[model samples]
Target chain A: MKIFGINLAGPVREEVERFLASNGLKLEKDVEYTAVAVCREEIVGTCSFAGNVVKCFAVRPDWQGAGIAAQLLTHISDILFSKGITETFIFTKPENGQLFSGLGYRSVAATPQVILLEGGTANIGRYINEMVREAGINGTEKAAIVMNCNPFTLGHRYLIETAARENEQVIVFVVEENRSCFSFTQRLNLVRQGTADLTNVIVIPGGRYIISANTFPTYFLKDRQISVYQELDALIFARYLAPAFNIRIRYVGTEPHCQVTNNYVEALQKILPSYGVKVCLVERVKSKGECISASRVRQLYEKCHWEELRDLLPPCTYDFLRNYPNPGSQANQAD
Target chain B: MDIKHPAKAGSLESNDIYVMVEPSSEEGIVLELDSIVMRQFGRHIEAAIKETVTKLGIDNIRIVAKDRGALDFTIKARVETAVKRALEE
Candidate 1:
């Protein structure tokens, strides 16, 4: 048997899809690199990776014990190392946990349907330890909020304010993935500036462990699988993040329009409480009977309606938008 | 020797080891070793790694070694190669 890398396009892509289907797996659309193990000129094992996360891994039933999966993983690791990605993650079925653990991957979090694991140079412990050291979080009655804040809005400030008022310390995790209109750095800065008045609030990047491409690839998953991923994401927060920071409550704004956000809130509600962390869903702050949302701010900014946006956004966000070069054109392409 | 970039050598096959070396903010060497035979040969394997890194005149680096029952010579060679590759960049 020989293992080699293959571009996931043309005839090779079709063969991989057929191979994965026979093994009860589907090809995730986000996979960037694929490698296959061929025995007797037929595909026996396959693995694919997108960024640092591995997906669509499988081996023929007869070839399972022959070390085919290990060979494919070695090939993928070489590719990842070449690209300077030392931390690797995999989301797989619960039963395959042992198989990966033997290959030096440690389990991060797991739900009934899916499990998350990490390997290579970085792990969740280091990520959490570094954050804890930097943030100096020692209090026990702290609350947490995770936000994308495509651009910080007045509604975000309100939720953070409510959490700050109720808890001894409030940790605001700005989603670090750059899939939104505003980059992660921009969103993080806006959240930091917008909540500067809340002395108890601490804003930091959510890192790869939370709502990131590795943890929750919402853009590539189906509707049913989305909720499972949401549960897995929430489990990580409840299990690792909350305990490390001594966070007891999580604050979220009530979703009025987006079904995905609502599902995330539902997942947090279902999982966090059992871990002793309460989920507090604050009502969305409204302006003139309409709820203030980041999307609304984005719409007005795209139309260059500063008069309307002045009410929806905080002073920092409004000033940033006013000085931003070609704001309307950039806002039009936002997710 | 200074590790200018993160680099790795070797593979995860049986009787093989994967070694990764990168620059660290903290002083001295930070080594994390995971061997299948860690219970019996963990200290010996760690000694082989530190001896190799020290011989190379490297002072501050972080190394992650995942061993699948590799021998001492194999570990030393992989560590030296990974450190060299890290410094070359």
Candidate 2:
């Protein structure tokens, strides 16, 4: 059997669809990398990926138990590996979980109908273990804070400071996904500058393994499906990430404006402790009883509300905002 | 290579190359290249495409290649595939 890449938007996609339909599976709309296993000019098996997660995997009943599925998976995995995606997740039926388990995937979470399996040379478990080992800290009380810090406002600083004060050390994982108005480098730099004085805090990139775009695409979408994204994100963090960091507490700011954030906090509150990761919601930093937020700062910048924006940001962030070029008028100097 | 029709191949994903080919009344191959590594590998990529199309023995065509750091083999393969698809009757 020969495995070849097929574009979902191309003519060959119909063959893939027919193959999937024959196996009682439907096409997953978001799939990107799709490979069809062809034998004697007939499509015998198919697999697809959405980010690092494998979806819509199917093999013809006649082709099953003959190693076609394994071949297909290996082919797709090679492609993903070449692109620097080492870790991968898959959602499959519970009965088929045993099959994947034999292929190096370990079951992380499961329900009667569906099971989530993660595997790779650098899976989350190994990655965190390595990071912790390199850190050389044992039995030190640690708290975790995952922040986007789109522009690193005072609100974020307040949350991190609170976490730092409560624990011996705070591990600050800045989300590495570049979906914000500021680039990842810019955001990371802003957070670094904003938190430079927090001697007890360790800043690190969250990589693509944490609340990444791969795991939580909807979170970065302009119109978010907040509840669904929140539940899934909270589950991944509580089940995998928090433990990896050896964090007993995850500190977040209470959301006064964004109902979506409040809902996420609620989900974290319900789920984190169940997995031994405590959720702490610190009251947000406020100016005149108004919660300080990155989005608010962006809005104020766009409106040229420098005075209010300055109030909402820390000195470092305020400086960055002041110097950030205005997209509306390219020629005008940032005031 | 000579283009008998308009066709396309490849994807815009990282480490992939997208090629769009169409019939051109112009006498020789007109190649347009856009790549993230245009400053570094741009000349090499163009040379690969030119070699592949010349080996295919078609002269009059239009080629638009959007590259995302594809390897030399990938560039050649994608260009050949696109040329063949465009030459299809």
Candidate 3:
């Protein structure tokens, strides 16, 4: 599918299409790579030098302008130098080949920048989905996700919105614990009640602490807990949903606030690519420069400064706050 | 340091294993060996250490690594982690 192209490189037409389909590349024509590239774990500025001809070298859009490809090209050049190959050649579209020229790889012609590495490079780069899913979804209909609506803020809302737009059915995961500023039934009720208007969205309980303390504790340092949870949910989701449905994407917010999570993300990026799961990092839902945070909203509600909370939450979240205590109210703890 | 400098110090880890920070002055660090493994590619490990240390902003600390069978990367990771932790502290 065109969607998640960088990650899946889905089906093509004719014999290639047949091979892709057989190989499990479920291309979505309308699906965009923008999301996939943003979720990409790690695709450093990638540059290549070759066997036949180094005709192509390009960095993903998200990674472009970071000089990532140039550096990568240089790294490979260093490798080539060790092997006694001082002169290297690159070919690509005239404009695109400038990148190679910039990196000291002379441009002989506007051709393909494909490379022939010294020892055959491994064809280990498999589409992430092919390895993960046994049966792939080729259509628009997809299943919904059930996730924790911990404190109910804008970040949570965006994840749901992203999934809802893509999937035919949406299942929201609300922590079925009462101690969540709004109780269990109340939290479920709140998420359920808030998305009630959206025909496709459904609300449900995220089982007990199965996901609690599930990921490494270091992830806790992230500004948003969901950032770390995104990877966790994606792994679980891919392992389970890929067979039943075309579970293509997992929406998560960028942890602009958490470098610790960013560090772990470095590894997740490397690992997830192996599984065909592209991790998306959505921009935070914000009022101004600051994202609407649950902690901030809860603080406002507790201080009885309810009005200021609106800037940070959707109207439904505020209305839920107005009712104040709901969800399995008597049963949960705030841990 | 405000500038990329070297550090030289002698830290002994247990007996029979001593570490030194060569050029114990500028942006370089040298690890001298006084143990048995010091001869078995110990110099290569120390060179890697200097490269890693310099990149890590270590200026004048020579570490006498009494490697009790620590892999190169492990030594790198542990030492870097220690150095990073120390610097952060």
Candidate 4:
């Protein structure tokens, strides 16, 4: 019988329950994999674990070759991982060797009725890079790249490259906690990784002050900061970042990518002039007769338009898109 | 909560910055509470004062706060009472 739903009164239920009892395995509560799979009206296999690891997984003898075992093992392992069972196992009859070979049940020292399932942790390094107090750039012509870059396309690279050529230093201050698709740090790192070759560009966390504080202006709490505190902050960036390094210019893209950021550039252009910082607004980097903006790139990403993106992005950026598990994500966040 | 108390009279410590009531600095007088508050709360106190100074204004004089763990509210009240005493001057 093809393994399917779990009906309590059916032959499969009794056998599954018997199998559970025989193996001394019990189901867990509130685990998505356990709850979802256990309640399924169709169940072709059985697996159980007590603590945070899977004890065993067995597809019905008749349904073994169809890869039902792999499905069950994946579901069961997913549950065990949630329960802190980083190592999982399976126990089964040795006579059915062929079915086990192709299935995910990697055979470890197996007894007559047991097979150990390998619980593996794939590439899952998700921690933020440690921010060392000393590792960042000290001073130079502190050029800040005010861009959403959305996902840091080739056009962004072209603009950044041009900015680097004309200035002694550059810092890309990413907007934090944006509701856009890629997060602040994600977008920041994309720029960092993409721009690693540029000797002068530094990535600084702008916090939300410049980003969302303007959106809801009332709660900035540092109200007087508008005059003195921010003046002091800008002074800190000036006194410490510029003189410490020798920064004199800031490079930004010309308008119309995001209307919100257009206003941002206009304001910075006015205030920055007094601080002896000149703003450089570069023309939009274009590919195949179209201007490369986050919005246009996002639309292409969502539609998986790789060919169009190829012409729009630089070679390094094109590689990032090509290597990205999912490309053509229609998204833009640097407003 | 009303926290009015008998104003303590003592000599203002030297090396500690102080001021006599003057007409010019009346718009605002931001004192560095760093010497008093620095050992305990450090930088967090600077932020607490911005909040404190805004609510109390520059009326409060002789703010000799021996701040250990005083929050924004305490700083405001202490400075307000200190100014209230100088108002009698």
- Winner by TM-score between candidate 4 and candidate 1: 1
* The 10-residue segment with the lowest total lDDT in model 1 chain A: A211-220
Report the C-alpha lDDT of model 4 over A184-258, residue by residue, as the tens digit: 766777878888989887766654223321222211222322222223234333333334334577676765556
Docking class of 3: incorrect
Q: List the residue pairs that clash in candidate 2.
A: B1-B58, B2-B58
Expressed as tens digits, the lDDT of each residue in A240-314 for candidate 1 is 898888889999999788787888889999999999999999999999899999888888787888899999999
Point out where model 4 deviates above 4 Å: A1-135, A212-246, A256-258, A315-335, B1-89
For model 4, residues B1-89, the per-residue Cα lDDT tens digits are 11122232111122121111212222344333423436566566555544554464443322323233455555555555444444453
Q: Per-residue lDDT for B1-89 in model 3, tens only?
A: 32222222211222212122222332345454333355687677677666777787766664534343445665566556535543542
DockQ for every model comes to 0.65, 0.02, 0.01, 0.01
Error of 4 at A302 (Å): 0.6
Q: Residue A162 in model 3: shift from native, Å?
A: 3.2
The better candidate by DockQ, 1 or 4, is 1
In candidate 3, what are the lDDT values of residues A1-335, reduced to their tens digit? 11122332533223233332443432223222211211234332223333222322345555566545434443444344345443344323345544443333332212121211211111111112332232322444444444445556766777678778776765554554344445567556657666777777656555422232223222122324444443443444444443334444444555577664455455345444565656556676777677766666766666656567776666777777766563333223242
lDDT of 4 at A83: 50
Order of quality (TM-score): 1, 2, 4, 3
Query: What is the lDDT, from 0 to 100, of the residue A76 in candidate 3?
Result: 48
Cα lDDT, all candidates: 0.86, 0.75, 0.44, 0.48
TM-score of chain A of each: 0.91, 0.79, 0.44, 0.47
Query: For each model in turn, which proportion of the native inter-chain contacts is also found?
Result: 0.55, 0.00, 0.00, 0.00
Where's the lowest-lDDT run of ten residues in candidate 4 chain A?
A: A122-131
